[model samples]
Target: MNTHRTAHRLVSRAATAAALATALGLGAVHTATASAPSAAPLSVRPAAPGPDGGWHQNGLHLTAAENKKVNGFVARARRAERAISPGVRAAARISHAELVGFDQRLKSPDSLKRKVATWMLESPGQTVDASLRKINDAVRFTLQWPAGTYSQGVRTAAGLLSAWGNDSTRWANTWNRPTGYKAINSAWRAPRSGQLFEVQFHTPESKAAQLETHKLYEEQRLPGTPPERVRELQEQQDAIFAAVPVPPGAERLTAPARRLPSPDPARRLPAPAPAPVG
Candidate 1:
């Protein structure tokens, strides 16, 4: 569900140089905005990265303290990923049984690391602990339905969300993304571990459209891109999503309600069954 950070490091340096040039009155430059995660409720809204965010945006070259912070968060998140992975896979299997063509995947460790590093660079005000908690895609699943079954996909999503929440808590939901974005994204707090993970719903066509526009998103994140070009790219993305038909009642899906009485903090899932030897 992610990409472009490593690739953009050099571009960022060039932008820095351009900033220096502008200070000398050689030319003017436009600063870029914050971007979202891979396999996430990845948004392209403009945000000023907080000062003192402990990141030197020279492509995520963190100070020793900041590096330790990222490593600590990754270690904790990996354990959480292991704890919920079995249930997540089981849920995916049940989803396929309920309706065909749904695809599920977890974000790769490298991708997670990149997301964390870049997020810190974009938000210097938060400590790594707080930043990681806010990142919901460390473990994520994508459910892709065919074009005509958007409504059915949303229904399947409701069932999956209900089951997944038995041992997890729903902490975030964004069904009403701006018109330019075309997907449903949510996060849940895993029981006992208290780590957050992401869930996304997409139609086959919409998924393809997202992949098609990913590069544009990267370029739009560059500080040197003229403001007009940024606006143009957003319009292009909107047009692509506009062509995707919204199934009746798809927008009405709600974030699952918090569990009644809440899940016990000390509760733990039983050990997952061993995989069958093939």
Candidate 2:
């Protein structure tokens, strides 16, 4: 099965990575005891529209009308993104510095259009502005630490919330689990622009599992995927994540209390790649 093959490859890769790190004069690889570091996500420029004047990404093709809708959202998202990006990146850098120890990187700017497009396509009938607002992870960051420092990672996430609060950033939610998904996924609104962004906290094990399951999940989400095939893919993801040990007290993690309900009713699960236009 693919899962077993992935596991075998991961084990082999982890061994090679560790040995390479030592030989390169780098110290111990910073990751969960059981995991190897996954490759960083690649950033790519927006592709030209497909032959039909529609958009094509990862087998998801949008009609000209859909493409127009998608592009509108993309433009607005980009404007909002530009206004908030500097402050957000600074906050991430400072927070990680203050908290100390973890692997960190921001989502690439060029990746936003497809991300916004995919979100809009998955949820039809929502207006472009409302849909743009609902889009989170436009300026996301992932922080991964060793499993041994699980509690410390939890504390850092809390510390980030507290510090961002002082700077007037409002957070919408925090999901920490072995429950919904393996990592702690949270959305925060930028101080002045009010654009929503995500910050995820993970252990090396969960990160590796995420890396393994990401493509599988994206494929599962594509349109035209048979229901049974979708179920099978979901099961594959579930099994991979089921193997990641949950951090102690992870369930106790919470976002700062909100006075009004979240503007976001429920943010949908993130899909790193596009779903087909159905």
Candidate 3:
């Protein structure tokens, strides 16, 4: 695999995911119930004019109705998550049976919005619609294990997810050796809803590095960041990742497709429903 290309792709995908979340206005509020009041329409006040006398924001601008639709979609997604959590948790436990530390969480609306905004600013011409169609990280988990067990732990987790509901065609296991950010990311397409949710597996050290680099990544996304500063931030991240020891067999981890048992579909979590657009 082309490590550089893979790294760039991973970064792009991560940005797109955030942008989709923001477009859906998922970060604007907490999950709502079916009977909750409809979201208030976004203000039509124009964005502050840029130096070029045009709005700096350059992406698919969502309409009030679309935002409302996104709100509805988020609400439905939350409900679906509740239904699927059990199976996912069970699979995670089995995947890291030997590990005593891990963390799991659904992506918050606020974080998603920030990522979306950053991507929109950086890639002005891209539409987030397609990305929004399949929002993965809406649900994710992180596994924390000793450095020596990282490879074994991640491989086991990936295998379990593959057997559960991971769509082989959409599976991605990207490792950022420079930043020590390794993840077994995949799309789990629930048979019923046909919605794809994301699962991520990470080692503890890698997780810590990811958190530390997040702020730097955000700063690099700012409109007027100096190129030198960007490079500096990257170097810092590289230094951190360079210190993380690669466990045995980690370099060869792959997510080969697996066929799940046909008789017990309910053993997996329900799939997400496509987000509705008004």
- The segments of candidate 3 whose C-alpha lies over 4 angstroms from its true place after superposition are 1-66, 97-104, 169-180, 260-278
Error of 3 at 252 (Å): 0.6
TM-score of each: 0.62, 0.59, 0.62
For model 3, residues 79-162, the per-residue Cα lDDT tens digits are 565544444444444434322212224455434434444555467664445435646665444445566766655655554445
Instruction: Provide the clash count, candidate 1.
Output: 4
Worst 10 residues of 1 by lDDT: 28-37
Each model's C-alpha lDDT?
0.51, 0.50, 0.49
Q: Model 2, residue 277: displacement in angstroms?
A: 38
TM-score attained by model 1 = 0.62
Candidate 2, residues 93-203, lDDT tens digits: the string is 322322112222334433454555566677786554555566676555555656666655455444433333313244432234333358777677755556566666777
Error of 1 at 40 (Å): 19
Model 3 TM-score, 2 decimals: 0.62
The better-scoring model by lDDT among 2 and 3 is 2
Candidates sorted by lDDT, best first: 1, 2, 3
Clashes of 2: 0
